[model samples]
Target: MTDRPDPFAAPFGSLFGDSMTQAELVDGTYSYSGSAQPMENFSLHPATHVLHYGSACFEGLKAHRQSNGTLALFRLDDHVERMRQSIGLLRMPVPDAALIRSLIIDAVEANADFTPDPPGSLYVRPTFIGTAPNIGAAAVPSDMGLLYVICSPVGDYFAGGIRPLTIYVETKVPRTTPQFGMVKSGANYVMALGPTLDAKRDHGADQVLFATADDITETGASNFFLIDDDRIITRQLDESFLHGVTRDSVITIAGDLGYSVEERPLSPSELADWAETGEVFLSGTAAVVAPVGTVIVEDSARTVRDGEPGPNTLRVRDALTTLLTGDADDPHGWRTTVSG
Candidate 1:
C-alpha cells in the first residue's frame, strides 16, 4: 500500500492497490496479457463513445482477508455475471464469463497484500467503457471497448460504521429510469446523485429511498428491506432495481437463521407502519447489510425500532460477514479463495 492514512480513516475506495488487470475488445474479439499489470491510466480519444454517449458500466465486489489469513472473494461468479449483464445492456460485447472471472482473480492476486483486516477488505471494481471514438454514434453502441479491473483497500462503505442510517423517502423522483435499474451502469448512479445530494442537504439523511408514486423500490445505492424477529420483506425482483448479490446472500442467511423471507412489492404506507414495528435495513455489494434508523416520509421522520441497530439486523450482518471471512462454513459455495 502507498503511504497514506489508513483506509479505515479515509473515505471508502480512496486507496487503490498497486496492480490491476485489463483487457480490450475490438472487432468483437477480446484480448488480454493474461495477468495483472501495474495500475495505470488510459489514453482515450476526445470523442470516445463512452465519454459522449455514456456506453459504460461497472461492478463492485470485494476480496476479504479471511480468518485463516488467506484472501477470498465473496460471490465472485455472481458479480462476474452481473458485470456481463451490465456490459450487454450497454450494447458492448460481453466478455466470456471465464475471462471476466480471470481478470478479477488476477487483480486480487496481484494486490493481495493490500487486503485489510476484518471489517476491511480490498474493494474490487470491474469497469467497461466503449472506446470507439465516434461522437456521431450517439444513438449507436460502440464497436470497440475496454474492460479493466481495479482494487481498492476499503473499510466501512457508509461513513458511520454499522450505525443505523437515516434514510430520506423520496416518493417523487425515481432512482433511475425504470427499465435500466438492474444494470450496473454509471449513468444510473449519476441520475440518482442529484436526489441523494438534495436529501443529504435538506434532511440530513444518509440515503434516499426512491418510493415513486408511493411504490417502494430501493435506495440510491442499496436494496431496502423491512425485517423483524419473524420475517424479512423486500421488493421482489423486477426491472425496477438492482438485484444485489448481498441481497440474495442476506435472504439465504435469513432463511438459514429461521426467518421467513418475503419478496414482494412494498409501499410507502406499509413502510410508515413497518417503521414502528420492524427494523429497516439496506443491502448491496458495498453496503453489505446496513440498518436504517429513520425514514423521512413526507418530510416527517419515522424512527425504526427505537432508532438503533436492531439485534436481527446485526445478526444478519454478522452472518454475512462470517461467510465472507470464512469464520463460518461456506454452505452456499459463495467464497472463491484467491491464491497468491
Candidate 2:
C-alpha cells in the first residue's frame, strides 16, 4: 500500500496524488493518452499564453470511498459539463465531455489508494491552460491549449471540520467582472483575492461574502444560502456568479426535505434580517454544506441565530453527506461508480 498522510492533518488541496492524466490541444484537436502518467512539472516557455494572457480554468470535484467499499465520484457529469463551459468561455476549443470524463476517471483510478475515509475523499481537479507561447496575443485567445486532471487527498475545507464559518460581508467590492462571473478561471479568483485577504486581515474572518452594492451573489469560493424552518433562500442564477453544482444539489435536497426553495436576488440588508431568525451557510464541492455562525456587515459582527450551527444546517449537511458516502439511496443518480 502507498503510504499516505492523515488527510485531516493536511490543508485542503495541499497534498496531491503521485500521478496525473493530461492532454494537449493543437490546431483545434486534443491528444490524450488513455491512462494516467507520473505527475511531473511541465517545461513551459516563459512566454506561454497562459502565463501572460491568462487563458486557464479548472474544476474541483471529489471521489468518495463509499460505505460498500467501492469508490464513487459525486456529480461527475455535472462537473465535466461545467468545465467544458469554462474552457469555452476562454475561447479555447473545448474538449468533448466524454474525453474530460475519461481523463478524470482515469486519474482517479490510478490514484485510488489516496482516497481517504468519509469526511475525507480524493479531490479531483481538472485544469486547462492555453499553451501557445505568445504574450503578444494579449487580446487574442490562444488556439493551442493543454488540459489535465490531478487528484489530491483532502479533508475539511474549513478548519475545525463541520463547524460554522464567520463571513465578512463586502457590500461595495464585487468579486469579479460581471461577464466573467460564471467562469472558473484563475483570473476570476485573483480578482477576488485582494478583497478576501483584506477581509481576513481586517476582520479575522474565514471568508468574504461579495454583496456588490447590497446585491448578494456569492462568496469568494462558495455559494451562500439562508435557511429557516420553512424556506431555503439563495441568490438566483444569473451571470453574476458561479452556478455551483453543490448549490443545485442542496436546492434539490431541500425540495425533497419539503422546504420552500426560493431563488431570487438577495441583498445585504435582507441577509441581515434573515439571519435574525434563520441560519446561513455556504455550499460548494470543497465546502460541502458548511454553516454560517456569524456574518460581519458594515463592520458589525452579527451572530447567526445564537452563534452556533443550527439544526436545519446540520440536517441539510447530513443529507448531502449520506448521499456522498453511499449510506443513503441516491435518488438523483448523482454518484458515478469507478472501477479499481
lDDT of each: 0.91, 0.93
Worst ten in a row by lDDT for model 2:
1-10
Per-residue CA lDDT of candidate 2, range 1-340, in tens?
3466788898898998899999989999999979899999999989999999889999999999999999999999999999999999998898999999999999999999899898899999999999988979999989788899999999998978888788999988899999999999999899999999999999989999998878999999999999999999999999879999999999999999999999999988888787788999999999999999999988998889898899998999999999999999999999999976
Candidate 1 deviant stretches above 4 angstroms: 1-4
151 Cα displacement, candidate 1 (Å): 0.3
Model 1: ten consecutive residues of lowest lDDT: 1-10
Evaluated with lDDT, which candidate comes out highest?
2
In candidate 1 the C-alpha lDDT for residue 320 amounts to 93
Instruction: List model 1 lDDT by residue over 158-245, tens digit each.
Output: 9868888999999889999988998999899999999999999999999999999888988988998899999999889988889889
lDDT (C-alpha) at residue 22 in model 1 = 93
